[model samples]
Target: MENDVLRNIALSYSPMIDRNRAVVATRLTVSALRTGGPLQADQLLAAIAEVWPEGGTRVSLNVMSETLLNDLLRAKPLSNVMIEIPSFIACDPVNTDAILQLQGNTLLLHGRPPSMLPRELLPRFKYSIVDLADDRRRNEVAGQAEAAGVTRSVGFVQSGVRTTAEMEASFGRGAVAILGWPIEDVVSQSGGRAGQPDMAVLVELIRRVDDAEDVDKLDAVLKRDPTLAFQLLRYINSPAFGLSVEISSFRHAIMLLGYKRLKRWLALLLATASKDVNMRPVMFASVRRGLFMEQLVANSGDEEMRGEVFICGVFSLLDRLFNKPFDELLKTIPVPERVYQALVESAGPYHPYLELTKAVETETAPVINEYAETLLMSLLEVNRAVLGTLTMAAQLE
Candidate 1:
């Protein structure tokens, strides 16, 4: 009856016999058992088997305790499982042996004062250290673990000299180094003061691109920024919108491509934007709006004007980044009159498409539907065009 009840709950979340279901059922069963229930070992094992048929026989040793632990170890349902061993629990030799009996793939060593895992048990388990103080301890513990034939995957809680060195050393040793925050975050917080040379080189490259009148100088400048160079080459080589022959160098590209194309490429490069979680949604929204507007204009007998319309859409969100009015920011760029008018006052011939794009960005679906009907366009057709443009942009990126 208890098995039936547990199986019912498991089926409620998922009916498939897969890893996801096994994880979910394990969690659910553990939760139920923890809440003062005197469940039998066989019952728990049976529940696990029902959820994870393949994984039932190789259950990891360190995953359970007391009767449940014994049951899982006996079952041997899964080959490997990640087990977390608290310092206090690891101090007990009996508990350590119990955990080793299960033969887990990775042992997550938690708590402080790394001496808890007995010397005898160290040789048997492939372990990764977690929650170590600074980088010094991380390296020391990793070194000790490696000496014991355990892979030293270290976790650094706080940033310090030791932590940085440990990360580098671990990489040297081919061990996984998990950073708390992204490296970019560390750079930003450090005021970019540490990497002045790299930044100086980038700024110099940008300046060269800005000042270059001839293709040779521009090509030389582009070589400095590989990312920018690749993007430029991609833009020039794109078939739907690019030239027929592949240009050999950046200089060739600049000379063959007019000023307008150069300016667009530069604008995209300048936007070397970070993909922060908060800004990602907004950036995607802007890209979608731009592509939608371009498609609308393309279908309106102005296919050549799609690029200009796309720019207006992309620049629409510039206000969010600069914290200024959109029209005020337009003065800096050499955009077309139609783009300026649509963005600033919605006065240009492309204003309706721009407005429709904005409506889509804001999720004012009814407005887009009404506008599409009035313009004698199918909503599905517009959606497909917008999606196609978005896919193209993603591929280019």
Candidate 2:
């Protein structure tokens, strides 16, 4: 995946946006080789300051090589950037004092084993970032850090962190700040050539328009999955729908939303249901994207456009969903030209809406405002839709 896409996904699920935590994670992407050019610490600090204005933003600098380390140390902090240094820095006894000098400005130790921490340095190391690869290791490290008179902020650096359970577990372990990748399905599911039954349900729903004409088949399918039916009713009756009367049954829902709208809701269901826990965040984000786009399109009073935008939002993660390249996957599914443009090339008339969806994911003020102006939508409207979408996801669960 592209770095920007990965960053967007990571940021979408991150609790840092809530701003309740004392320590915040600050991510950095830099190469140690200096293949592109010299590391511009000034520019890097400026960007971090803008996104993480809070004084407690904890930055994890991925040190690639010794050369990169030297460059970073030379650059002075302009915006109170508290740099975190690995405990391994003390391995070299020659530069121990120099490294300690940088301590007051940032944390001296970054989640290392107690054995690795030098005895002399223990008295100097007041604050640390703890390593939390697993429960046993986390407890051992946290206990060790505490004994040394060091307080810690923790995180999980290992890969394959995909579910709500995993995320919450890390935080429960006393991680004031945690860091993980963009949350995608790292583990492939077992099962067959045609994919899972739940996925097939989505395909069948799309292919069968007869259900719209004859509500009996649609009702039968809903009957087969009572959970799906209940969720659909709950969604239609939600405050976002602004319905005075509640939707009580599948047939009633079909009558109100029609076959086309019903198909879209089923598509949304397919996106949310994933056998692999890693895909949960991606799926949640996809549903939110669709709902956001639908709100933007509804404002224009264009019924057809609203449907297309929803499709665009829901199916945006097909490549990640199937673990296949997007271009190859698009050939198998039959979507409108507008959706193809928005998901693939990111061009055409619907492209602007997709752009707005992306901006919402990033939650950056400048980017969100820019897209809002392009769609003639107020930032307030966009924010409300985002909050509504998140609420909708929780209710669906």
What TM-score does candidate 1 reach? 0.43
What TM-score fits each model? 0.43, 0.55
Maximum-lDDT candidate = 2
User: Candidate 2, after superposition: displacement of residue 123 in Å?
Assistant: 22
Query: Candidate 2 overall Cα lDDT vs. reference?
Result: 0.57
Residue 75 lDDT in candidate 1: 46
- Per-residue CA lDDT of candidate 2, range 291-360, in tens? 7778776667488788888988988876767766657777766677888887788798788878877755
> How close to the true structure is residue 6 of candidate 2, measured as C-alpha lDDT?
19
Candidate 1, residues 1-397, lDDT tens digits: the string is 5343232111101000121111111111121212234434566445444433554322222233344444543444434333445556666665766667656444545345445567766655454433334334434554575677864434322212122333344444443333221222222232323123333343444455445456675566556657667765775576535467887666776678755556555544333333333233334445555656666766565544866777777667655544446677665555678888877887877777776765543334457666666667665455545445544544454
Q: Provide the overall lDDT of each model, using Cα atoms, as 2-decimal numbers.
A: 0.47, 0.57
